[model samples]
Target chain A: MNDTSTAKTGLQSEAGAAMKQNRTAEGTVGEVYVDDPRMTCRNVDVYYGEKQAIFDVSLDVGKNQVISMIGPSGCGKSTFLRCLNRMNDTIDICRVTGQIKMDGQDIYDGGLDVVPLRASVGMVFQKPNPFPKSIYDNIAYGPRIHGLCDDKQHLDSIVEKSLQRAGLWEEVKDRLDQPGTGLSGGQQQRLCIARAIAVSPEVILMDEPCSALDPIATAKIEELIDELRENFTIAIVTHSMQQAARVSQRTAYFHLGKLIEVGETDQIFTSPRHKLTEDYITGRFG
Target chain B: MNNQQQHQKTMERVQQGLDRRYRKERHFRWLGLGAIILGLLFVSFLFITIISNGYTAFQQTYVKLDVFYDPEMIAPIGETDPEVLSRANYGGLIKASMRQMFPEVTNRREKKVLYGLISTGASYELRNAVMSNPALIGSKAEVWVVADDDVDMLIKGHIDLRLPESDRRIKDNQLGWIHLLQEQDRIEKRFNTTFFTAGDSREPELSGIKGAIAGSFFTLLICLTIAFPVGVAAAVYLEEFAPKNRWTDLIEVNINNLAAVPSIVFGLLGLAVFINFFGLPRSVPLVGGLVLALMTLPTIIIASRAALKSVPPSIREAALGIGASPMQTITHHVLPLALPGMLTGTIIGMAQALGETAPLLMIGMVAFIVDVPGSVMDPSAVLPVQIYLWADSPERAFVERTSAAIMVLLAFLISMNLLAVWLRKKFERRW
Candidate 1:
């Protein structure tokens, strides 16, 4: 928090002002949490080789609360969401330098193992990936690998309960042995959510989970998200401003790799404090 | 000049351009189709020629003869001893039996014709007869021995008896005896089990592919065992874990180059390293298999990497995001999905290895072996080397044997490729 404003912000420089203006906009950044946070990210900077993706982005995911990050494309919303669980480690050229803490422990410490860290902070991707296994196996994968259940009956119950929580159990009960890829796109996404929850994670980071779905499936997922927040802390990155307003209790608007403004979902949509956030929400220029 | 006229002119030009482009596209497609048809036709011609020339080798001709196993002639001591029977002049007995069959042929040249009807290996049958049944040592027994190459060709109708005697390998006098044997029902054609049961022999009828087949089997077995695990591990390391650096890049380039290297060069390497340096037995399936494994490893690795690449990145992300470690993710997910393609590639490499001759030849597998290889450590000659040996022989009957060996090799290759196709179909993920 102490390094928030002065350390970064290259838009106001005299040199390259005209060229940078297209991608950079003035914004205020802070981690606004109403209650104790399950996780905290401070002054996070992401770079892909020479190009910096996220600049001095600070955020907090409130315990058992749903926080949605909304921005236009290339605004680093998804990149910052991935930073919570270190999902960006998959990219060879991607480099992240920052402080990320989960449950009072440093997630990015050199000795910290990524396996348990990922297990604690599970993720649902922009696209549904069901591991080319059966629906039951897909949900059982996390628990089986983590040894959460000792026997087959216990693993089966966990899978059943997770699928029930995702609201896909009734639809897929008889076809648990069928390939998860055979499901509809929306069902596949729900299966992914079930897979993430089966691990019993403390937090779930979703990167545009419903972007590929139609209106009906999207509405169902938004409803499911509201229910999921009661059990697990959630952070989602989305392109739709209405979705952010609908699903999240707190909304953080990002512009040009910087958090433009953050407040409660109601206040941010009703009266955004930053001009860029207001402009982005009012559909003036995204 | 007017706006409407300008628009019409532009439309006309666009229409002409579209027509010209369509014609070009059509011409290119036809050219491609023609090339494919020509290639297929050439392959069909080769198959037809081989099938027609080689199908006869699957059956061999035999002649039934009555041999008087006079105990005095075989063993003067009147004993059923293996040494006495083995030392007996069975070649003289074969010639004398043929003379008894045609008592009217007394001229020296005509006696030569009668001698030509029975194989020189007829003595082998006589020796085997006395050795197996010592009771036959003093008795007259009727045994069906193999016919000579000239008589077999004449009976099979491969030789043109209608031609002048000077122009035919089967002389007119030989054909008269062949017809007499036909009338007496003494000559018969049976399924050539010997072709599958014996090894290379100087006599065409006695030669078979059993040795080469066993050698190929052992070599491929070793190749699969070593190449699969090592190739898969190398592929996983290169694909999933290896850092992108100049060192890795160099290793990748060399792997690809090794894949393209000639099989003979590998033979030379095997000779230098395995035979000279390690002092392993020459012409053994063990050294041949090691060489084949080296040759196939690159292909397996490349194929496995491709299969790993085909797996969507989202699957990797999902597994990692779920707390599975890197090795776990591969073993649990990536490797399972990539295995089908890996196996397919391995089979293709094995098929190529099975047909490999130059490397095995250089490693001394070109030696004429008369016994089927019983183990990998035994001196062996694979099918391709047998085919090479037959192809190089001066005997006219060896032509049929060469093509027949090729047919067997092709059968193995086809089955391997078919297995690969079936595996791909069975395990391929739609995702």
Candidate 2:
């Protein structure tokens, strides 16, 4: 521990030249767009009643890649993620003014229905909130509501395949009739993941899905995220910088409701361009 | 060292006050326990008083008589007609049997007193028996007939026999006759089936609460059918769909105030609207039920709203996050989670409706009803109203019947509360 602390301090002082005293400039540093994007967000501002929560944020989520958003508490990362699927509409006073396009079509258009949009872009909460039902029912809920299956047999296959993809089939196969809430914390999170996948969504938004689990469970989820990236574009907001470095190809750093930096994960962690991002990644302050 | 000495002084002060602190705590605990014990004492006292006062009403006194139903006396018109047989002087037959048993009562007034031993309802009983079996005309059968209400009170020790003959309803001559009948085993007490099967009557011994029970059943059926769905729907709309604004707040306040409104005012409203304006018949369960439903609506709505509110918001979010519509989410997730609470509330409201009497009284349900109600439109009495009417009577026997009716009402209330508890326990889920 002492050797690592000395090494970290040595590294911090060497990169201390990038740190600036006035860190209030609002423009984002590094790359904010990708060559091939699945979803594009530009000039997004969010407000709760009269209080502005996010100001003029722009970023791109590349196709079939995991982008990790790391920020302090109340930094608007989760709020921005909720805006992607229009989940913020459930709030009475929340208002969003921006253009978010999925495949070059505006998602916030009045003609667009949130039902199909949510079905395509599913979310997993920070807490592993499995429905108080059987494991089989939990997995089949999405497909049943969306009318994606032709018959009971097809629904059964979808439930089985979703669970297999989430890496929870072997553990829970014998107890498909047991309540989803009766599972361990890690298994419950995976069940939520399998539930999201049951609808065959194109993108999965995860809001600190492993914050409520132990180290072993976090490792298991990190592994599952790597496996899920082959078929789905994933955006995850995390409090842990190590988790962002481990599972993401792109990293976005938010500070006080502003997107401070967005760049390749290896470059952002190794050589941060913005002072706020350098200070945040170096454990100087949140 | 000086700092340590100051700390020791503070510790010493605390130690000195510890006993006083503990004494106060003990005093508070004992005060709470005393309050609970006082409440329990009152409840037990009430139950004991009711049970002791009412238990004797379950048994009725009967007089055994050997009546020779002669065909000559029964069909004196010689028509062999059912109407003539039913109109036969069954009272004279009982008189003859009593004369045979007590041959010394030859004076006219003594004969009148002797005839008073059997209830006037017994003549109707005998007439019905003879009507059902015309062949019984020539038979001599020993039948146990209901004694008069005064005789019942005397046999049950409610009538003070120590009082002077002039002060007693049962005179000296009546006592002598009852003693003689008791010695011969001719007088007996049996389970009062008449009290359960018969309807209201001028004679206390012939009256029962069967009509009131039937009326209560119909009234509560109508009340639940009207109140449950409408109350639940109103609660769901207010809690889930309506925006939280001044209008809904005012409505919420009005509903709460309505629950506290006097029930008699509702009775007056029922009289004006249902009986006068709508021209519904007086003294029927429909109007009574309508009145009770109006009274119980606020209670049901409040309970259902609380039940809906108890469902964690996370469940609603989970459903909505999965692309389920608002209606679908509430129906599939929120409603199922809240149903146990709603049903519990509805049962409690029904129990409250069952015990209500004042509103029913305003609608004229206090009138004497003879036949058990066959439909909601029939003139009827409810249990509480029956108890009220009986309690106002001058008869000693009616007092016991009043308490017995109260016991029945209490039993219905306790069982409904138990059912509510069981339902809540059975469906109480953990998040």
Candidate 3:
């Protein structure tokens, strides 16, 4: 036990030395901008009361493209995603500064109403959070709240279409009156996705949407994400490297409350510009 | 080999302690079972004592009398007018009938002892019969009248005949009269309708809890109406909308403390604020209900807040993420999820209100009200106050009545608690 303890300490010191060498650079690297951008965030900083959570971070989500954020836990990836639609306003101590704009309109403006912004920029959570209601009611809730359709018939068609777009129509069409919670984890996640889709949002933020799911369910979600990219701009926070690589066109890497790199998915994986991003992708340390 | 020996030694020590551990566990199990049995024994004892003591109050004794309604005695002017019928001396009719039954008793004191077998209220019964049917005047008819309370005690076997005549309320002469009536099947025990239908009376046989029950019903109705909505609103605002700060924290602490405050304080508050300042009528259900509502508000608010807090925050996030406003999210999702729990809390608070005696007594509900209250504004006495009054009375009959009133109050409390449990089970939802 003494020998192994000594050996572990030795390895930790060596890794610590390497980490100290890489800590000299403090800002993001690689391409952080895109042509034909849909939403732009510049120098975004988040603070929870006295503690700063996210440093100055700038990135762009392109039109009709999938952008995946990958980082270790508590790396502010989910925090940054919540900032896109001002969802952080619900937290009492959470304070965000810096500019985030969708279609050249500042979402953080005091005069801007958050309700419409949220409706347009929908969210899917880390866990499947279906309302304790019927499956049909779950999907129809978003549309009814937003008054997207004029009549019940229109709303029903919207629900059916959204479910079809989520690739869940066949499995759940006969049981729409049953509770959404009665479904399996994978199906419930799809129901949440369909609920998001029913509002016809222009942008969707998914915060580690596959973490609580089994691998088979995770694979199904990746497939759904690929198909969903045709109509909506999607930004996903994920821990799984394979999931980020498979579905996202662009990938951004975060480390210790700082954005380290952002680029094309293939370029970032093959030739990371920053030592931290390369070290993270190569599994040296998260 | 040395490590293996040490492991074997440890195993031996563990095996030795396992027996003692199992013995302790068995002892604990027996102790728990004994405690449960003891609790059940106490509960059953209470039930037996109450039921045994109170069940006889449900039946009353009646004496059969052959009444002769003579025209001269009833209407002195011989007109048989309605006023004359109502004001006539019906006691004379009862005495004449008793005289006809026992012709051998001629002395005035013996005749007075013979008349003592009937209740004073029996004259009113005869007058009502005469007024309802005036044709019965100047004719003899057999009627069943309520017997006196002493004769009732004797018939129910509560008054022991083996005791000396002075020790018991019923003397030998009265016992003989009762025996003679019993031999001819003129004494009977009937289900006590007056106990359910009539209001409180000085006569134990004429007293009933109908007034108290109506008073309780109206008080609880007013209490529920005032407490439920206001409590739920305060809970929702504090839980969902209010910012977390020192003020809200202080408010929360005060609410919890208010629940612990003695109930009579609220009655004093009602007495000062509602009766003295606002000048609402005293001893009315309205005042009692308002006082009870003040007492019940803290309990309901605390329970409702807890119910609201039990809803998972993720559901709130889901609703907000879908662009629902905070108010809309609460109305559409969170309130529906928490309603059953809130209802349960409200019912439990109501039960507490129903069983509350001190608060009502402080608010002047201890007044000896005899008339059944027709509305909320009418002066009245609630059930617990009635029980307190009856328990304090000197009459032997009021002792059983007190127990019977307690039984009724317990029945209502148990049913309300059962409803709370059923509501909880019916809507207990899982995410």
User: Candidate 1 chain B, which ten residues in sequence have the lowest lDDT sum?
Assistant: B70-79
Tens digit of per-residue lDDT, candidate 2, span A100-152: 99989899999999888888898898998888899999999999999999999
RMSD of candidate 1 to the truth, in angstroms, is 4.1
Residue pairs with clashing backbones, model 1? none
lDDT on C-alpha atoms for all candidate structures: 0.88, 0.91, 0.90
Writing each residue's lDDT as its tens digit, candidate 2 over B1-431 gives 99999999999999999999999999999999999999999999999999999999999999999999877778742345787887789988888899999999999999899889899999888888888777788789999999999999999999987887898989899999999999999999999998889888889999998998999999998898899999999999999999888999999999999999999999999999999999999999999999999999999999999999999887777777778888988899989999999999999999999999999989999998999999999999999999999999998899999898899889999999999999999999885
Candidate 1 local lDDT, B366-411, one digit each (tens): 9999999899999989999999999999877889999999999999
Residues B177-262 of candidate 3 have per-residue lDDT tens digits of 88899999999999988888877888888889999999999999999999999999999999988999999999999999999999
Using all chains and alpha carbons, the TM-scores for the candidates as numbered come to 0.92, 0.93, 0.93
Ranking by TM-score: 2, 3, 1
Which runs in model 1 stand beyond 4 Å of their true positions?
Answer: A1-33, B1-4, B67-96, B106-113, B126-142, B161-168
Candidate 3, residues A157-268: lDDT per residue as tens digits?
9999999999899999999999999999999999999998899989999999999999999989999999999999999999989889999999999876778788899988
Docking class of 1: medium
Least lDDT summed over 10 consecutive residues: which range in candidate 1 chain A?
A: A14-23
TM-score of 1: 0.92
Best by DockQ: 1
Q: What interface root-mean-square deviation (Å) does model 1 yield?
A: 0.6
